[model samples]
Target: MPIVNFAVAVEKGKAHLDAGRPDLAAFLFGQVLEAHPTHPDAVNGMVSVLMQMGRADEAMALLRRGLEANPNHPDMRVNRGALYLMTNDYESAIRTYEGLLAEEPDDPVQLVNLGGAYMGIGRIEDALDCFRRATEVAPDYGGGHLNLGMLRMVLDTEGSAAAAEADFRRALDCDPNLHGAWLNICTLRRRAGDPEGARDAAEMALILAPHLLDYHQNFAECLLALGRRGDARKVLESLLQVNASFLPAELALAQIAVDEDRPAAAIAHLHRGTELRPQDPLIWANLAALLHRQGRIEQADTALDRALTLDPGNAAARMHKGRIQLAGGRLADGLANLAAMYDLPEVAAQSPFGRLEGAEPAWDGGPLAADLPQGGHLVLAPEPDESLTFLMFRFVAAAREKVARITFLDFRGLGPLAGQVPGIDAVAAVGDGADIPCDAIQRLGALPGLLPGALADPGATVPYLTPPPAAAKAWKDRLSALAGIANLPTIGLLWCPEGRRDPGDERALPLQQAERLLQVPNVRFVSLQFGPAQNELDELAQGGLVTRLGQHVDSPSALAGALAAVDLVIAVDGPAADLAGAMGLRAWVLLPHMPEWRWAQKDGAPIWYPTVTAFRQARAGDWESAVAAAARSLERMLGD
Candidate 1:
């Protein structure tokens, strides 16, 4: 009777160990062994606890003795197989499980466990077969169905959405409460473009286990894919409420906040997340990215360093650190870092020669003025940024002073009134100047309009060769005027850098804000906006606050004429501002919180453009203040 009581006590101890109460189970098993030193049940229970606690050597020692006493125990064989699996001795585990299976042909649990061991050894086909056999042995085993479905998902083609859906459906049929099956089904529906179906599957999973974090995360992903970002946020927020320390939900929230242009909120959540999971490499990398965008370059660098220290093979951390160095003006260090990590696309993009819009790299100081000596040959190269344009403009003006008497043909092509002034000696519109050297040819070019971290071939050139003077000027003038006056003191607003997918570009002012210039007494605001936002300018002009001037001009001369006529130009960090500086026009340039490579950090006047005044955004997403400051500067200029 006392031996039976000892067995009951051992059973309770094993149950505690199964439920993750190892400390309590060890204490209970100790009490049982102290009272009954020779009890087989007590010895077995203590061995199970040791195995669960990962003390494999201790567990094996006791199990060896127990198995010597009872050589035919199926449970002992199964336990030993599990221990082998834990140690990644897949061959041994497989042998043990197969022997047990031979003795008991219809053991569903062992079949599934054997499949897991096969998977560990990269024998995916064998694992799939084992799971399939498991289902054959136990047709109603939900876990086996789910395992088979997951394996099929990997083995299937990218277009096998239908097959994936079927497998997930069968898994659910086997066990209605299989949350993983529901999650996979929802993902399949999403890939198939059936949002409602995805939502239905997600809801079914949530209904079964509302507290399951993975189920909630899957539902949130479905909501995001369905264009219900707000709903997605709510689901993630609920998960956070349930478990504040949940890293997955916190990271998801941070990403959503960034997409919605709430970088501050993203930073806040990520800060807490990194603090909670200080050792998680991913958390540190994510935090670094958010910090970098928010203008916290130093903090971002520190975070990236921490991530690299924690995980030396973290490519993202290495890439981000290189970018931060580049942004911080550590050019050589950045370049070296970038070169080291160029295998990463992001690092490759940090190169100055990255893909640029309409990019044309100047010859490497080879054959200076080879194409220039031809009289009436107009080299129409629009400036890329205000700094470069300003320097080039001054250099050209100085070069003209130094090399007097050479027939240097000048053409104005970007910004307000660029072509109207007409002070250059031999300048003429294309096809209009007949007196010029017939042997002379024109070389017209456009700005590259590149952004930070974009990469291109060393000698990439623009698609369209620079047009003849009149034609190039016409297009440049028209585009510039359209950008500046598209709404009125033609504020040539450019809210983003070319080639950037970062959040700083997307949350810019709507074109309607350009119309706000009409509110200023006797002032006209113009649209200098470019890139994707240009598509909306025509619609914005219907309000009559701004006029679209870029419609007819494809040549630079067209834009030059428009640039020559505007009163004052205001712009964000873009090529248009550079065009204005090259034309020697007064402009107010709105800079990002941290200026780009050309702008530099000294805080005084920019060296390239003397007529340009730079205004930096005080904080991230504070474009409103930047705009307001521009309005005030305009008021003073117009004597308002």
Candidate 2:
């Protein structure tokens, strides 16, 4: 071939590079460089192709040869610096860029590259200065503004969020097609509680770069936040079809399945994810969580062990292991694992309550060195679950006897019910933020650990809560109207299987299984189930098994009255059972083979609820046996 054909080869290489065929580009450039060793275009083109192929060492050698041939070639020098940055040789990259800047002091591209090198080496302040200078030198440079905004986001201070938003907007103004800038704006808006704005920004990004996976993922997340879960699921499913090995898409599908109460589907998705990425501890941990929710304790433990083996310091895996052990009646082992979470730096950093800061050491269940201040101690309710509320009531009643001033901070608008508990000096809503001037604050769930022997021997049970007289009378009159139809015993039937998210929990007796209880000769069944389970009630009514009463039983006070009015309450282990125990009402709680820790395995009755009888399933997911035993018990109660 003619030596003049070297320029033709170089031209062909440039065409391949533009067509996104880096391998072909590299081959053509190699031919050109073989003929003309000092050809600048061919050398730079080969280096770019090598870098694209992740052959950084090869790219560096070629760049060195190119710079040796032409000592003043700026493009080859810049490529060399970029190769250093790619290889994570931040110091070398910084020195190279600094040398380039010395020659061309006001080069915006060099400044931006320098900023990236500084960021790679943790010199955040220096990186910010470089980005600022780059933006100032070229006011229309969108990349400079984008990098500046990203750094501000990482800083994450009080006013940094707003500043980041401004920089991102400026980047978009400079270049409307900047997809990265649009994605950042989407995230910032979502974090600021503007889901609609987030959706708009995400849509713009998707339009600009439809093939980008992150844009699709973030758009789906925005849809989820806006309560468009169906839409989110469709988007995620489409993403999975495009790339089945995409871990994020798999995890998102699992989350949607969990939310929709399809544990089987969630498990399937996680199983596929684990198969694809067997070493990912987070995927194994998520699988364990779903198994635990389904009451598969042994399987859940096995999954957690795999996670812990892969990542021993995983706080989420450790926490889950502790809960599983606790559910299996290993209290000491469980508490030890749970307490270790507080000591883990990763866990402490993630806690929304903030790290255990200040001069005062964290109260680790040790005896108080001295009495609390005159203002006494404040007890904050962790959540609004009925069981949690009742447990808090027990702690408050016990603490009031010793502490002079005990204040209860109720966050769930449970002040009305908490006010009913005697010895509470002040029952205030959390939003009130009334300064109680307490010496120390204790989370209500933490009280059990602080009180020695509290779990070992749960002391005498008492009626801690009662329905208001008016509410009780209203329910009584409501039930009296039904008395004329059936003079038999009135039993409140609660057949809710699981919480909203956990649709098919093993602890819940299926309505079909529960219908066997209604077969008992003379008993009136009233539905105590809540939420959007009217369809379930209508099915039971069609089968002549139960009557709906959920409409009248809305508030907690009303629920208490309904429980009080009934002759007996039959329910699974849920809020209804917790309420019955709190009110000291007669109840028969059906338990799964591996019940919650609160329902410790026993023979006759639970110590916590003297009037409640717990019937356990012989095997896991054997609600039929539990239902049969409950049926016999109900029949015997009617005979009595």
Candidate 3:
């Protein structure tokens, strides 16, 4: 009667397991094993549950015990074989599956299971053979088709999209409720850029099982591709409602928040996601990137450290951490980290994104131009305020001795500032004299000079130089004050840069909002901008809420000098913020929802600029919220 009771318990456990309640099934199976010490069914059920929970060692122990008691039990043997696969003990799994295959050669399920073990060990060809054979044995087996399709997806070429698509579709046809097949189909559709098709497939899968988190994430991606961002966000939110622990859903939510220019929300979502999935290297890497953008360098370091702990060999994490260290002026530490990465086999072969080849030094001064001479004298154009170049200079100063071997050449317009600054040899305009080969030329905005038809001839040997602190500071104070107005809160406004075409640039406010800022009591708004929008601002500022400074400031350093006298600087996506950062000036930066990589993924006050604060758009293409935040900060500042 006791043995019969064990049998009944095992039957109930099997039913629960089939229904996907592995925890409940495991509990019941444990009771059966307690009633009958050698109950094969209970032992198998527990092993399966433990394996699903990633407790591979415990599952293996149970399998061994089952084998000791009933060595020839086919189901126990199969379960033990499966447990080996979970532990990545592929050799053992294969041996066990092979032995069982001898006893039940026609068992299609065992064949499919063996295929999975083969795939886990990277034996793609063998796995394909097993799946194909399993399919042949049971023509209607949807799992066999799904497994075969997945293997093909990895090993096949991009050109084989049609084949992969057909296989996935066939699997779905064989078992209409097959979730894996549906997901794969959506993935294939996405790869082909058929966003609508992808969304439809994902929706179909979700209809069958609303609890599939992966389906929700995939559907969100599809919706984003289809330009249905609102719909995608709703789907992600619904997923979080169903399963708060869903890591992928959180990542999707963060992406949506960033899309809407809600960097604060994005940061919060990412933090929760990382906590739930601490072992996920991608999440950690992303969190570090976000923290760094917000200028929280120390926190970024800690996040990266955690990521490396989760995956010691994650090359992306190492590269980013190295860059962050370099940006933070930890020259030796950053360089050492970057150099150490070269020892990693994967990074040594190629960076996670690409080969880590050192950038080639540009040859700006040219004998090729023939009119150029080596070591030609030149003037330097003062570095732009708050530019990437300024950021690089801070790194150089902290690490100067280390980079002493590198040469420094100033551009012609910038020669005066170069003379006034600490380290420099000579300066020349791109067209000042005969083209010359120099060790370096500084400033990225000067990239036009190196273009094909620019003044500097091709093949000239010239290295580009980054900004020094004094040069960066001089530029912001000089240019920002050019608007020629007096008083506290001497606001510097830069709505856009000259020449346009910058994807990151945006119209900071509508004419109505610009008027509102001007109307704000006691705030002196000055236009230090250099763009065609002067006419529009003049029309908008006719009553005296704004002052245009472009005429007074001659160069970036002059602007920097002028900016130093101002109480506040407000800008968006230009060298001005970088200049303000270098000068340690109190500045507010208006960033689009999807900020550049340098700004990181989340919105926060950056660690790179102690005096700078960020205001992000609340949604894509919406500047209303950002302007309001600026207004609030200004009001608070005035009140204080």
> Largest TM-score belongs to which candidate?
1
lDDT of 1 by residue, 1-640 (tens): 2323666677788877765577788887878767765456666777778986689988888777767877777677788888888788999999998898888877887888888888888999889888889889888888888877777777777755666677677878888878778888877777678999999889888887675677888889878888899999999998988878878788888889988889889998888888888999888988888788777878889999999899977877776776677555564455445434545566345322232212333322122243444532223332323333333332232222322222323323332223332222344333212244422221211111111222232111111112235654554555455533444344434444341234546334444554444455655554444445555755664446655444443434443344445677666666556556666666667776766544543336554455678876777656666667766766786794
How displaced is residue 319 in candidate 2, in Å? 3.9
Q: Please identify model 2 stretches exceeding 4 Å from their true place.
A: 1-70, 81-246, 249-280, 294-296, 306-315, 335-384, 392-407, 410-431, 437-439, 459-487, 494-521, 526-558, 589-600, 603-640
C-alpha lDDT values of all predictions:
0.61, 0.77, 0.65
Tell how far residue 332 is off in model 3, in angstroms.
10
Tens-digit lDDT string for candidate 3 (1-640):
2435777788888887766678789888877777776678789888888876789888888878888999888888988888777778889989988888898887788888888888888888899899899889987888888888888888777656787777778888888888878888888887888888888888887777665567778778888888888988888888888778988878888878877767678888999987897778888888887776565768888999999898887777887777876555454455445545545675444321122112223334332221334333221223323354454443322222222222333433444433333333444444322234433333332333333332122112111222445645765555455554444467877766442335434534444455545666877777776655544665674446776665555566655655665678887756677667666678888777645433432135564565678887876566777877887888888999
What TM-score number comes out for model 2?
A: 0.66
**Mind sharing the TM-score for model 1?**
0.67
In candidate 2, what are the lDDT values of residues 1-640, reduced to their tens digit?
A: 5346777888888888865678788888878777788789889999999998799998889888888998788888888899999999999999999999999888988998999999999999999999999899998998889999999999999999999999999998999988989999998998999999999999999988776777889899999999999999999999988878888888898999988878899999999999999999999999998898777778889999999999988888898898777656676577556655655676455432232234233334433323655344544443325664574465556555555565667655566666777767677665523444555555555666666665674425357777777778988888888844357788898866333325556666667777678889777888877666534766553356577788776677777788999999998888778778878888989988767766764455565666788888886678888999999988887899
Q: How many residue pairs clash in model 2?
A: 0
Clashes of each: 58, 0, 66
